[model samples]
Each structure stands twice: as C-alpha cells, then as structure tokens.
Target: MSFRPVIISLVVLALAGLALAFAPTGTTARPDQGDARPFQLRDTEGNLVTDTSLRGQVVLLYFGYTFCPDVCPTELGYVARVLRAMGDDVERTTPLFVTVDPERDTPELLKGYAPLFHPRIRALTGTPEELAAVFKTFGVTARKVPGAGSHYLMDHSSSITVLDRQGRVAATIGSTDTIARSVTTLRDILGKP
Candidate 1:
C-alpha cells in the first residue's frame, strides 16, 4: 500500500542520516601516536589475521590497492628497499598491503601483486563493512572516485603506519617521506643506532 512505501522511505532516510552523522568529518581525523587499534581482516592466502597475529612484530601497514596509479607503488617500493636494508631484522617485521579497493583487489589479486613489489610484503582485504570499520579505527579515509571508462580508483590516505612490537603506532610515514627517513624510522623501531 501507499502507506507501506511511505514508511519504508522514512526508515531509509533516517538510516542515511544516522550514517552521515557517524561518518568521519573530512580527513582531519589522524591516528594518535601509540594507539593500537585491533583489527581483523583476511590475508592474501585467505587466512584471517588479527591484531593478536601481529603481536610481537613490527608492522609497516600501508593501505593501497594493486591498481593504484602512483602513490601506492612509490611508497611500497621505498618500503621494499627499507625492508631489504633491515637485513636479518626483517624477520621480526611484517609489511602489509591493505587494499582500499576491495571490490577489485581480491585475495587472489593481492597474492600475485604483493610479492611482485616486495617479497616481504603481504596483502589483506575484507568485506566493505569490515574495511570501513578498520579504516575508521585507524583514522584512514578512502572513497572510490570515478576513473577512466568503467573503472574507478580509490582516494585514500597515503601514510604508512609503523606499529612496534606492542602493536602501538610508532610512526606515520607521509607520502613524500624520503627513503632515508623511512629506513631511519624502521631502524628506530628496531632499536638500531
């Protein structure tokens, strides 16, 4: 009946309003240093990796997708070099590639892409809701923007979050951070001089 349709429309509008109210305002929300937000998402092999799984390891988590045009690859390349320079200390480090565009970057896609950039890096992804929650917890913002043809690209925060063994965010690597700075940051995390 007309009344039923009206009620459904009202309910939908209310839900939309609630969502907007709760959504992060702009990109001002930055992750505070040493805040370790627990998260659970599927890895490249489809295994669920949680905060507990990353315990006792230094984590270099970069949110990106394989299809990213520039920034993702550039940052990842620097990370690879830094990890390689870590020598044996790399054993205690975990580099993660978490996709902002999970719709196209499946576990299988990551399996093939992550290793190509760095042997030490692994990829992760999850349901849209799961991704949204994780992003919110980390103060990351990612939204799909229209691209060429039918394809689309994600506009997301390009910072790399460095988590120490305690899973606390130790450093935030900006998009323009030099490779030397990245290496220095990693060394600092590993207690190297």
Candidate 2:
C-alpha cells in the first residue's frame, strides 16, 4: 500500500509538470482563420441559428453567465459604450451573449437580460452538449461550481471574439481595453468591407 501511494504521487507530479510545460501561455490563442467552419446555435427565441444568419456584418461574441457577479455586467456595459459611440454606424454590427450557465439562464431569462444592454445585442443558450460543442469550436472553456442546492456559478473566458463578414474570426478583444478602443477596432474592421 505504501509503495502504491508513492508511485501514484510521483505519477501525479509528473503529469502536472508535463501539463505546465505544454500549456498555452496567453489570454487568447489564435485559431486557424482559414478554417472557417460554420456553427449553429440557438437564439433567445428558441430558433435554430447558423453562422450565415450573421452574414454581411461584424459579429461580436461574448461568452459569460448572467449570474456573473461582476465581469458580465462590466463587459456588457463596455459593449454598450462601444455601440453608443458608433451611433447609427452600429447597425452593421451584431453582439451575441452566450450564457455559460445554461441550467439557470433560460430563454426567458435571456429575454429580460439581453435588452438591458444595447437593443442590437442578443443572448443565447442551448443544451450542455450544444454549448460544449460551440465552446470547443470557439476555444472557450467554462465550468459550473456548486453554490447552494442545485444552484451554481460559472467561470468562463472574458475575451470577446470578433468575426468578420466571412464568418471567420478576424480578431479578439479582451476585457482589458477601453471601450473607445474597442469601438474603434470594431469600426475599423467593419470599414474593410
């Protein structure tokens, strides 16, 4: 028994070391832009959606939970600020809010939450499997933790993904930047085509 425990500890340490050695060392990892595969996700209306649904526009995707105490609200506010700065020019941009905590964030909940931001913004949720698939494709990681009873809180990447008219990820905007820069960057991308 002692020998087995010792061996297990060594194996665990080795695995940890390997993980640290190979782990990515940045806030965002660039995806192969050439691999512009389309993805399907549901909107707050429970309607089926696809990447093409966002054609002829610049799409901003933010993965977060409504229950998020601080980050979600702040980021959404930033998005709102950016939109406000754009004024009428914001028509060509679409902002999507994907809830990482789907168990509690239903379509009805999103209906109430999404409108709190700019009118152009929308919120979406799907089954765990559906969300997992989309998250993986977007390289977003999320998890739910116990809180009280069946209730839980979620953690996810705060980075926002910006997709061009071609439905390809053109650039990523993190939470670190000011709303002004974010709006400028988005407008610059929209000006391209």
Task: Score candidate 2 by TM-score against the native.
Answer: 0.84
User: Which tens-of-lDDT digit does each residue in 1-193 have in candidate 2?
Assistant: 6799999999999999999998744336775556454777889888977788888889989999888979999888788888888888789999999888888888999999988987888898887788888888788878677889877887678888888887888778866897778888888888876
lDDT of 1 at 29: 50
Clash count per candidate: 0, 0
Q: How does model 2 fare in lDDT?
A: 0.83
Candidate 1 — which pairs collide? none
What is the lDDT, from 0 to 100, of the residue 173 in candidate 1?
A: 72
Indicate which candidate wins on TM-score: 2
Task: For model 1, give the 10-residue run with minimal summed lDDT.
Answer: 26-35
lDDT of 1 by residue, 115-185 (tens): 88788898999888878888887778888999899998887888888888877777877547776787778
Report lDDT (CA) for all predictions.
Answer: 0.82, 0.83
